[model samples]
Target chain A: MYQTISENQRHEFIAKLQPVLPEIQYYLPSFLDRRILFVMNKMGFADWQNFMSYLDNDHSYDAIFSFLMVPVTEFFRDSLVWHTLFHTIVPKLIKNDPCHVWFPDCSSGHEVYSLCMLLDILNVRNRVRIYAGCKSQQTIDKIQTGVYSAQCESMLVANYKNAEIPYDISKYYTINYNSLICNPELLSNVSFIHSSSLLEDEVPQISLIMYRNSLLYYTTDSQHTFITTMYKKMNFGAYLLLGIKEGGNIFGLQALFSTYNKDLGLYRKK
Target chain B: MEIATTYKLIVIGGSAGSFASVNHILQELPARFPIPIVICMHRLKHVNSGFKETLEIVSKNKVVEPFHNDLLEPGHIYIVPANYHMMIQSDMRVLFSTEELVNFTRPSIDVLFYSVAQSFGKNAIGIILSGAHKDGVDGLHDMYKIGATTVVQDPQEAQVPTMPQAVLDVMKPHYIFTLRSMIAFLKAHI
Candidate 1:
């Protein structure tokens, strides 16, 4: 029920891959071969050179990125992680002072909206500013439109229950025909920005960054550089959330941050 | 003479009744099973904790749910983690994605099979097992189109015949195996 794509998806992947032949060149040699061939097969391209023929058709970039992307994600993904964010991290962040949350690469608006609901329920929505940054204006508009398939309501409700956030799920959205329109007031303080790279337009004085599942798209070096940039910009003891699969494989940056929960990819700035 | 070394990889996919079949295969293989074997069996996203451990308890070879960008090792068994789509690169690195579910299931059989078709092609073995969905048909067909050895679990022997039957409805695979014959084929090849 939580699956949706951003219009900036093509551009964002292009931005991430612009470095090396659409960035496949920079993938660990092993990753490059594995993914290239996989993509070729999925798209019915005959071979490597045929796949590389993407340079010939600009339109093919979208198709290529679509295959590679874990592009759409659900709300309250890894419910345990959201629970920890609400019960443990939010309290700590609020105790420090007025706070801001950045979803540095929010391809889908569900997670961003999920966080807003939690903040509103905590009655701390007034104290916090949320910035939802996306690569394309289409995604920005989609977030603003805020409608979801009615079928997704049950899934979202289950996730909310699992996340242990206390609130009536029905109060957030109203049903129309076959869709649910999220209440727009949730984002009264949330700002939408058309920025792909956090390295370029990062908002300073950030208390929390929900940059999960998006990191693996970059080559390892790019991953490191992005992390290092984020590390320097974050506030003292600020919280960083990563995808569950990413924490262990990030190579060496373990010393730069301490893990709040190794199981859920929550890290605290050193 | 061992594991028909001509094939570099084997990918198996299923839903519903595939667990026992997968468990039996892992239980029978020797420790040095030769080339890698990756399975994409569907399971609940929230039921993530003990699957790999359960498989390892029955496997002669080490079993793992790969982390992102992991290099696949020969003689090992890799299970696609829950809610993640898995694929292989030409270099044998296993990758995972949280993309929209293909065939309405993550750990899609088609994603893994089509990927190995491109990566290993004729040098791979693609197997379909018992399940309730048609997920493995296109993937197995991709492998067949690429000249990889393709096998379907005999629908008559399948716990849920829909999946194997679905593949049979499309095209003939190289073999139609019962779980017992499938084990014998592997042991004989080794």
Candidate 2:
């Protein structure tokens, strides 16, 4: 029989894991003993002996929690989201020349690319400056590389189709066998930052902020906290896009933004 | 006949805290590391896609949303698309299912781990990261059953202990380490 963690032990575990709260809240309910046992076996703990030995040694749970927060992104993900941005949002923002847009979890510059592509299609490339952020230096380097693979090309093609943006997709990439490197010019007007959400102090005022699908991992409380902070940073009438499932109700902070979009559920400050 | 030389495959599954965890592991890994990584993250049923780019930027690994029948390759990270369950085939091809969501997740970790264990056997490495539910517990056990190496992020280090701790309670992983050490282990082994 699998040994179950006592409520006390579970409490201790939760206390240890608190640094990653809110994001972990979504997964806390279903972690019964059987499930823990199953995870132990899957990780090759091999019965009780190995498990006890691991517990006895020095272990850093924060490192493990970091291992769990794998935020993977692609260029121009969710064609509809980009479509809405290009057709509806960008047009409104472009009226204000030299508009600044912020992407908090820019990750590898795909969202940057999406934004650039939108600006290019709208013929507003010279009228915008983008501030994109990622927590990893390595990703910042990749964003500097301005290269991508053919696998990325497929999605870019789809995004182009959905947004009805006109450009030869092949022209933006230089093919090397199966891989496709994005043209350097596509990234000329972007700025990259290596920062974490917890550490950011101040942000430039901007007309639009796209934080797509990045905040769902946080706990609802943290989500509210971050949203509150973001609300402070955003300009009046600034637009914010959260993950589809995220950002419907701001609890007591209902005056910040009004929710819109049936398929995408985007929020904009009133 | 001797098998052709190829990179070992590592598949990691998790829900919460996955972004930070994957980034930590990938950051510790050198650019020359010779292994492919497949990730299955729990996402909303109708969510907008951007996760692949997010992971790619954070990890600096080549990340893509896995397409139906896409050939699995080394040096690239494939993410199971949202609203679909991703699985691996005997020949290392990617597969997807639009079947009803299990545990309310389309890109389930268990489904991916089980398929990879079946396909690669001992060559496969299965990891269960931080999450709220028991989604990957069964699949990690399946990996152990198939003689593949299995790992869970030490619950002490997990953003959500329920997911990794749940595995620790049931599964006896060969190794349990923080994301840094896990990346070091994978780098050395790969």
Candidate 3:
């Protein structure tokens, strides 16, 4: 459908979205181009003008934003990084005062739950406080439900095995109606926030921040803004983990943080 | 055959016994090569250390694993990090997806080739090299359909022939050269 649109019409369509969801400016044109197709299809519109007409309708903004912000994450998505976090980083953080961990973009709470499992195995679950942040209230509500699709069970098991977890992963969940409900007791200390790192508002200081693959979705300038702001919200000697492919040197981040383990995308606040 | 005057990107895909051949190709390129190159080599998920630094030691061009959101730049070789499928977004920045595997491989050759076909179209150049199985044939076909220059390693000389043979069986690539001749072909055309 995008191929049929004129180049000028495409830009005009993007310009229409710029004000309502100001964050679109932070994404690359190609990424947005692909996503806009998904957006148009979800909104039940075939043409740009139809999309525009619906946007002008009453109470459409929230539904559009929710569609654009669907969470895409899996349990132990990057197993090797989780391995290092469990064996090295988590132990180091626990040695300090009761660890305060944060997941700035907790897209569906996979990362948060992964950390919970690690802390549980280490027998330090009582000594931690987790702050999981999301871009939308709808996602926050979904995370609170603690349900994951049954189709992902095999992949989740494979990831745990890859991470070398010694115990059976099934102990953590109860299967019901094609979904896995994570044990409610394990989530007792977690708090969900409807926030973005780019926001300048005050947030709690954290000891370890897991801001992974989501950074690639942002524009470079937005990346610089969010990373620097996130740096200020972290406590002294905190550790920051990014996606294995997320190189941090572009924004003078090297000057602010020392390379903890380049392969794992771990950085230590200097 | 007509040759394009220039290209926006060059993508190379290989697996199995391709490391030495790719290393030789990288060693042959000039320090400030005019176009950016992306290489996708199938690797074990557990083996994730020093592939970038090791390549940097021998190549004239800078070798680095592109971070997410990293913009494409000339004179550098972007190594696709293992365990993830990489796609080039319309903005020409790197987008990594942890979606289910394709062709039984993450960082699948076809995934990168399809994205390059979408982003660069006729302005892209795609090369398929030595591999154990038919991983890159579909990608080369996608590049061919989009009017991009498609090349493959000569199966006769490849350490493993299944990959190049599959492409030869499906469609005629623009060039099928051995490692030594491939470097010369690139210098002459690129």
Task: Give the winner by lDDT.
Answer: 3
For model 2, what is the C-alpha lDDT against the true structure? 0.67
Alpha-carbon runs more than 4 Å astray in model 1: A1-71, B1-4, B47-50
Superposed model 2: Cα runs more than 4 Å off? A1-69, A198-201, A247-253, B1-106, B109-190
Ranking, DockQ, top scorer first:
1, 3, 2
Candidate with best TM-score: 1
* lDDT over C-alpha atoms for residue B49 of model 1: 52
DockQ of each: 0.31, 0.02, 0.30
Per-residue lDDT over A1-270 for candidate 2, one digit per residue giving the tens place of the 0 to 100 score: 113566655554445444533234333222323334554554676565565556446254322332233333456666677777877888998887668888776655767876786788778887888887765566677767876666767666765676565565566667687776777687777777766453363567778878765453343466567677778777778787765433354332356787766346477777
The native-contact fractions of the candidates, in order shown, are: 0.47, 0.00, 0.34
Better of 1 and 3 by DockQ: 1
Judged by DockQ relative to the true structure, which candidate is superior, 2 or 3? 3
Task: Please give, for residues A136-165, the per-residue lDDT of candidate 3 as tens digits.
Answer: 676777777878898767767878988986
In candidate 2, residue A124 scores what lDDT? 89
What lDDT score goes with residue A18 in model 3? 64
Q: What are the per-residue Cα lDDT tens digits for candidate 3 across B32-85?
A: 888888999998765455667778987999887877767888898999988778
Better of 1 and 2 by TM-score: 1
Per-residue alpha-carbon lDDT of model 1 for A1-270, expressed as tens digits?
Answer: 111223343334445466423334334443444454456668897644454456454542445544443445566778899888888889889987769888877776888888888888888988898887666565677778988788767778777888887778778888899987889899897988776456666586788988887776667787787788778868989988988777657754586788888678788888
